[model samples]
Target: MGKSLYSQIGSLQNDLNATVGSTENTQPSSKVNRVTRDAEVTKQQILDAAVIEFAKNGLFGARTDAIAKSAGVAPRMIYYYFQSKEGLYQAVLEQPASEFQQMLEQMNLEELPAIEALQVFLRTVIAYEISHRYQGMLLFQEANQNQGKYFQQTNWSQPLTYVTKILEKGMQEGTFCKQDPYMTTLTIAGICVFYANAYENLKHLTPDVELLSDEMIERYTQAAINLVLNGVLA
Candidate 1:
């Protein structure tokens, strides 16, 4: 066994850290840092494997043994870290949800006029989902098959709330045709989300096209934005 996985990951982290500001900004490598990085590396390994398993088999159907094998860790490690299968699934759900929220926070979508905000939101969400297509499949399973039992437990409404606010703003300004913001928000989300969630089906449109390639993503993003803007236009 040459360099272990942790060794490889640690080396990569070192390289990444080196690219940071001037050498004066660097901290001396410490034992604690290495230990912490390795632990996080292990956890990320488990999450990455769990995404694949959960996407293929919904929460009730996914197996710990399979996840452990795919993660190259002992089955016990999953229990030790996550406490239970549900807990692990929650972590998977949480990571991406939190990331999207953070991305939203950074975007300041509320500052823009409703129409511009809507376009930005549509493009942002479509791109986000396309980049994480596997997670989109996992989300589809949870939403449809699991009845969103796990998702509802999360702060999943933040994005929808953002959309609703934008919609209400547009309606108020007479830029968008008046409609129920909450209902319209759901409709708009379905429009953007379906492209990624139904990717497996969409891929069969023609064998020649790479549905997730950069060109297709832009096309899909623009199409979704256009559809929503057209429907809402005053």
Candidate 2:
């Protein structure tokens, strides 16, 4: 028989604990060349582990030892490479911004009409969030933690700059209502991130909702597009 969801969560927690404890207790190996190679390996592993760690636990609750274990690295190696867990979280975030930007750049948005552009962008955003759940989870965690200052410093600029241009185009062409482009971007992003970030918590609240299913995803995408296109006015 399959385990209960609660038991599965408990199992995951317990496994993380064992992995963390093992890494924390092991002593670093002594070979210089081996240490260098190991350090590089550890750093990559840490980056991968950190996306899940920071996403699940946020910055304050996530443990360095847990991250190290998840990455299969010595506990201290995270500090040696990243200086702190916060630094590792920042590194994990860097890739998503560039990846999103490259994807956006490749699309010839200028060729599409305004409403078509909006729909296309929504589809792209939803696809990206769905496909890159880990990256989306990290973003969701950061946004949920509401570390406004940190996010403001790190990410607030680039995406806003790009999105603002698109929204401005939409507004000018009368596809969208005249609204603050920046705030609209936040609303659109919030719509995507909230469900993902809160999925674990939400599952408890709505146990019958099979959120990961293809039907639900299509339902969500359609609802999200409608909500954005037509404001909540009965």
Candidate 3:
């Protein structure tokens, strides 16, 4: 059974108590011997665990003790690498930005026809969004908690920039409606991510809805794809 929201926070705080009773002594490891692979592995593990905690609890509610337990590391090690829990949250925010940048690198968006490129981009975004749905909530938490200071700092514009380019190409090719590409990109993104970021509220609204089930995901993905294509395609 899942823990209640407040319970999750309480449990994590308890774990934090166990992991690092005193943070004053805990600091980033000063000892380094050429950035060993083992250390890198540890950082990755911590990152993975931190993502879960940050996503579930947000920055203020997330507890490093729980993250330490999940990552199978001493609390100090988190401090060693991330310097602090907030630092770890910032890194978590960066993970998706890094991923999107890497995904862009792997795609030959420029070679594809504008419509085809847009399709491919939507598919990729949906897949990425579904897999990391929690990050959207994490981002929402960022906005509500800090007025989006960290979000503004992150490189989240890579995909959007590509979408803008795709719109320009489609317009130039006379295949898509000539409209403001930037606003269109935002509209497309919102339409695609609506269900994902609204899970908490939505699940309650329709308690029977299997939001993450394979059937629902496929339905939502197709619906989003079709809607965007219809809107943009001339």
In order, candidate lDDTs are: 0.80, 0.66, 0.77
Best by lDDT: 1
Runs off by more than 4 Å, candidate 1: 1-29, 143-145
Which pairs of residues collide in candidate 3?
16-65, 28-80
What 10-residue stretch in candidate 1 is worst by lDDT?
Answer: 1-10
Provide the lDDT at 41 for model 3: 71
lDDT of 2 by residue, 54-108 (tens): 8788877888899888888888888888887777777777756655665566666
Per-residue alpha-carbon lDDT of candidate 1 for residues 1-234, written as tens digits (9 for 90 to 100): 111322333443345333223323336655556666667778888988999899889898999999999999999999989999999998998777776776777678889999999987787777667656788878877987789889888887887899999999998999999888899998998898888888889789877999776677677777787888999999
Error of 3 at 127 (Å): 1.0
lDDT for each residue of candidate 3 in 1-234, tens digit (9 for 90 to 100): 111322333443334323222333334432232245467678888988998888788888999999999999999999999899878989999877876766666677889999888877776676667666788878888888889988888898887899999999999999998899999999998876777788778889878878777667667777887898889888
Separately for all candidates shown, the number of backbone clashes (residues 3 or more apart, or on different chains) is 0, 0, 2
RMSD in angstroms, all models? 7.7, 10.4, 10.5
TM-score of each: 0.82, 0.67, 0.79
lDDT-sorted candidate list, best first: 1, 3, 2
What TM-score should be assigned to candidate 3? 0.79
Of 2 and 3, the candidate ahead on TM-score is 3
Which pairs clash in model 2? Answer: none
Candidate closest to the true structure, highest TM-score:
1
